[model samples]
Target chain A: MNEPTRPLPRANELDTQEFWAATKNKELRYQQCDGCNTVVFYPRRHCTGCTSGNLTWKLSKGFGTVYTFSVVRQSYHPFFRGKVPYAVAWIELEEGPRILSNVIDVDDPLVDVQISMKVELVWEEHEEINIPLFKPVD
Target chain B: MKQRDAAIVGIHEYQSRDVEGKVSALQIKAESAARALEDAGLSWSDVDAIYDAGDGGGMNGLTIAEYFGLKPTVIDTTNVGGSSYEFHAAHAKRDIASGKANAALLTYGSTAHSNARAIGVGGAGGAGRHPADNMDVFSGMTLVANYAMVAHRHMHDYGTTSEQLAEISIATRCHAMRNPDAVRAMEDLEFLDIRETTIDDVTNSRMIADPLHLLECCMISDGGGAVVIASPEVAKNCRKTPVWVLGSGEATKYPQAGGDITASAGAYSGAQAFGEAGITPAEIDIAMIYDSFSITVMVLLEDLGFCKKGEGGAWVEGGRLRFDRPSDGPALNTDGGGLSSNHPGMRGIFLLIEAARQLRGESCSQVPDAKLAVAHGNGGMLGSRHAAGTIIMGRD
Candidate 1:
């Protein structure tokens, strides 16, 4: 089969590259406010919680629980057609952040993916970006 | 609250993929506008004001207005990301408050599926020009990447897992199964069947920029939806029972959603709406929220005070969104949210229409005895860098 096409990596500012780099390792990391010690999700120069310019990057333990999700049985885009029955979810990280990701592993009958199933990291290599995925931990 | 005569006497929506048929954005928008007007039993000449709520894509509203052959003496093009309809309500309120407009019409449409770079006027009355900054979403974390980071942060902090998120998707799909317009809804589908789906499967799923898995983002639909807002008198004169906009509020946070989502968030948006409505969050009977992304809904869980700020992950653990439970808990998006509902170009209008229908007890699939309802919107992401509005609605 021919190589399926992919969307090129969209942005490349100096600050965002590191976060993307971490995704390739299947290890999640975020910038934290050095002042309030609040961990930030999208890497940025300042903390949104405490207005602190002091921020630091920390590696995540790569664990979380599903918060909310949906299974897309209809693909609105050619990019997602074959994956119609795929899962889309918002996993709350152990570090107090909520992000969107894919859920893998296990059998999904009505996908009782549940509201809080434990999950860990998995990675998918795209043409330009390595995407992070999660699977239910046994 | 200021007593006004405006009511949504009409409602309609298109599918999430009509843009695939190669229809121009304006054509789709005009079709929706006409459909809504016809549903309301009105014509274009009755509209004294017009508001165009479009994501920074095509400048189709004015073009459509011209094509429709109506002269709107009072007009605004508040092209906020997704909250355009609600924002249009705000604009109408301001116009009415200032005694500028009598009857206003709000319309939204997009073709994110066809064009990557949306084009519009460089100045006023132009489309694609949002009053808020778009650099972060279009360029920074983009859509998927930024939310991915937030999902990662959420996982690390609350110990939320991907399986939990997957469960949300699964449950929503079940809800979608009942909605005919839902782009994707499957009762028999499971997460594992899709676990192996590659990034390519998601990437091509309709790449609206990057890092956002095809599934992580909202549909880049080529359809349009519309609503007409008139003073209370005109509304009462119309055919349908008016679902009064009792109270409403709009809020903004940081300029960029590419960082921590905690500060300056949805709570502010929810607070304003509840405050304006003079009702506690506990009093809300039903909700039709904007679910542009899964994270948007999760954050609203905390923002609306349904759960503690970070406890949203645990709130839906038991499939509580199902209609089986008839408790004080708010019945939400009973027909399927943006996730399962029709996520055409202008999604907020769908929420507004559904909220009105629920209040009118006219929904095709009604939430039993739904009297008071909330229609919330997140124009962008968690931070509200763009614009987020909440409308507290009640049956008259």
Candidate 2:
């Protein structure tokens, strides 16, 4: 089947290229500082914890808990014009570093959802990138 | 070095309007400066420094200086979001104390109304493929969504109800009812209407983001504000009574960079301000805390030590913020704040103006015998990359 079309993130940047590339294989990768053992997200070259440049990528267990969330009832983006009332949340990964993603498979996710609810990483194939998403574990 | 006293000797604001044939942003700045200088009984030559708190993206100080035909030795252009002017005021106080500048003029103006730019929300433009657009692209992040996330987290962690947040909007609307200069009364500005609002009204309002209703958001306005800060000697010679800058503090942190959404840098900045002022939170007579949204005030109250963390929702209940419950706290947002009054993008300067007026006994809803006032503003986002500028003002 053809990949569903959506706004795709660019993977040409020096810092975030690897993270985007990893998403193509359904992997959630974050950088681990060699000196401080700190995990960083949004693909950083240096450790935010210790400012160390010696960093390495590691695959996440892909499971996390909902830190906080909001149901985007209104959107200015033309892509989301008809897709109102979507739930978006910040997931606190088990390995550390929180990432923002949409929570699917739940009705009225904003009201029915609870903090610390278990969720796992998922992916949506778009024209240009494999977008990382999350869903509450059934 | 001993800290020399500095004070705000004059203040003025161009009414927020949206008339046809609106003048340039620089003209608004010039008019505000001229009026503020007149209010302070000073001429252009008296302004030894100029601080541009302009939100427009450019070299604000140079632009304003050239437009106003001033050649000050010092030109400060510090941009920290909505609270940039509070930071400017803090810096100006220090500059005057250190003899770097004798008279510093701080000015701000925005054409959000004239340009018809949606002041809040996500602003104009849609998400496009950018090599650097990060995770926000997929999530479809907007300003309302960001604050709603905080409200949701605050509710989950502390059991703070939506009703609690709504109370802030109600009280601010009540305050706005008393301010003739508020955006609500602006002619031809029908959307800026100020009317009686309740918890039910807030809860029933159209949801911009889950948990944040239309009532909870701040009113966008096009306004200009100016304040002249001077050394104690110059303040003594001014036309109006000088409102003393007792203390000021500023802090900046970014989200996705370890900033806590529920907690802001106001905790640190407020502590620094209160410590410098040698006063306690209870001693404050009035507070002009920024209210970009209802949750903004709730989080700030907790962070600024008005109440313990997680107690802000409870503290504001039962007409506490309206100064109705004598046992609760000081008068909050007496000038209606951004929620009901005017939010011209960045609202930091308005906070200073309101606080100065309260201390000067010039506010319409004047706190009885108001001696000390606190003005705090948060800029940026709920968690991601924010600035908090807190100022403590007093009448000595």
Best-performing candidate as measured by lDDT: 2
iRMS (Å) per candidate: 11.2, 3.1
Model 1 segments beyond 4 Å from truth?
A1-138, B1-5, B54-62, B114-142, B183-217, B255-260
Model 1 error, position B289 (Å): 1.8
TM-score of 1: 0.64
> Which has the greatest DockQ?
2
C-alpha root-mean-square deviation, candidate 1: 10.0
**What ranges in model 2 sit over 4 Å off?**
A1-6, B1-4, B123-133, B183-187, B256-259, B323-327
What DockQ does each prediction reach against the true complex?
Answer: 0.04, 0.51
lDDT of model 2 at position A59: 91
Tens-place lDDT digits, model 1, residues A1-138: 765342333335445667666666666777778788776765666677796458888887878887645454433333444444555665667876565567777576134465568888777676555766788887
lDDT of 1 at B251: 75
Best by TM-score: 2
